[model samples]
Target: MSTHSISLLLVGIEGSEFRLAAEMARANGADVSTADTVDAALTHLRTHGADLVMIDICLDAISFLERMRSERLSAPVIACGIDAPARLAVAAIHAGARDYLPLPPEAELIAAAIQTFANRMAAPIEIEALVGHTVADVERELILQTLERCHGNRTSASTILGISVRTMRNKLRTFIEAGIPVSPAA
Candidate 1:
């Protein structure tokens, strides 16, 4: 069963592709709507609440998404397009999109992404939920990358990461709890 009521607003020009995508999403039990242009979409957003908004990451899309963020739309959006560029993907995520996908996405991929987004939206945020950084996720990645850069030298890793030897040991303890294996260098 789906985790949440899946309603979506698909923003793209009127075309066979958009219609097909809309049908595909609806077939997966999503309540789907369409907006042929940016202004129309923004107006729709003001009146209707949707779980997701899948948009074409075209020139108009870039502008539309920026405006959405500036206007503080809270619905999680997923940008979709044919051969979307890496920078566009980064920009979309930064603009508060939950994820981005290529056009005509596989059924399973679409379903999985929708499920993941729903789960994430429903999950509670907790101090303990911060499994990264203070939970040693960031520190561990840095340690691994730095160790790799230092040719597996603990002293050099410490210098690169700007942490003392004892601090590194303390971090290792947290890293162990985070389930990251210590590199042989440590």
Candidate 2:
């Protein structure tokens, strides 16, 4: 089965707003869940590994962020509210929300919001993830990881790495000739 990126937790939004947000997120491939309070959201996060979080600004979102910090819940957060003032959006960001999503959801905006966070799912390259002891080894690993991130789509990985598709194909060929297993190109 194809994996969907949205394992979203919705907190404090109710009635039409909650339904709408969930529907929009689902329409854009999110597997959405809900929580009416901060404690409940925390409990859910602790139990279920996930995800991008969306909490209503009208609720005690700042408190949630503080508690999430104290509890070390590392999921990135997004704030949602109806007619929220500018200060509140700034405050949400200051409190560690990745972005704000205004309510009475719009599909395009939800897609954009999901895309913004989806891009962050690529983990940073770490020393431990690299194999072998040479600069060539690092370069090979980076290219392979980037290709994996792009789901074996050479064109996309090439664009991100600022290289051409021909070069990517050549590199993959070289790696394969060297007995390195590579993802099948899409």
Candidate 3:
């Protein structure tokens, strides 16, 4: 359903089911590749850098996930299995699968999972940006409060912050240069 083309790797799924799923993914603008084993899947992943990976639970999903993690693959992985029990799904999730699907996976579910992964990937960057901004704001406020509590004494503020007096002066200078108002030593 996404306009963006996703490069997907499929592991341990075959027969008409694989073909059907592959075809559906292709129709939804995904470039999909299939592998019959974990090693083969890893090879494809290392070489092609897939956007997403779908692994069958029968293929040792946990091991595959471990390998991917060890190799530092950033692609999101979805574990799928026919008649997969709740425990198996839990295991897949615990093993680092981003999502799980019952096989043969429905095209709608696959699309939704991929979209969810995309959203998840995007969220972290935004969250990190916000966190960085918030941390900077807190740092500025803390430094100002420390300076005020020290009665504008750089040495005392530095000691309290566990920083050198020179470092404290440099930080205060930075604030002043940034147009932040600071009270004179009293």
User: Cα RMSDs of all predictions?
Assistant: 9.2, 10.9, 13.7
Q: Show model 1 residue runs off by greater than 4 Å.
A: 121-186
Q: Model 1, range 8-92, lDDT digits (tens) per residue?
A: 8888888746557787777777788999888998999989967788888883666777788788776777788788788988777
Q: Cα deviation of 4 in candidate 2 (Å)?
A: 3.9
Instruction: Give one digit per residue, the lDDT tens place, for model 2 in 114-142.
Output: 77766656545566755556888877988
User: Clash pairs of candidate 3?
Assistant: none
- Backbone collisions counted per model: 0, 0, 0
Residue-level lDDT of model 3, residues 1-186, one tens digit each, is: 445667878886568364466776776667889998899999998888888888888889989988987998767788888887888888887677866788776889877766765555455453454465677687787778988997888766665565777887787799899999875775
Local distance difference test values of all predictions, in order? 0.74, 0.81, 0.77
Q: Sorted by lDDT, highest first, which candidate order results?
A: 2, 3, 1
Residue 165 CA error for candidate 3 (Å)? 40
Poorest stretch of ten by lDDT in candidate 2: 122-131
Question: Which has the higher lDDT value, candidate number 2 or candidate number 3?
Answer: 2
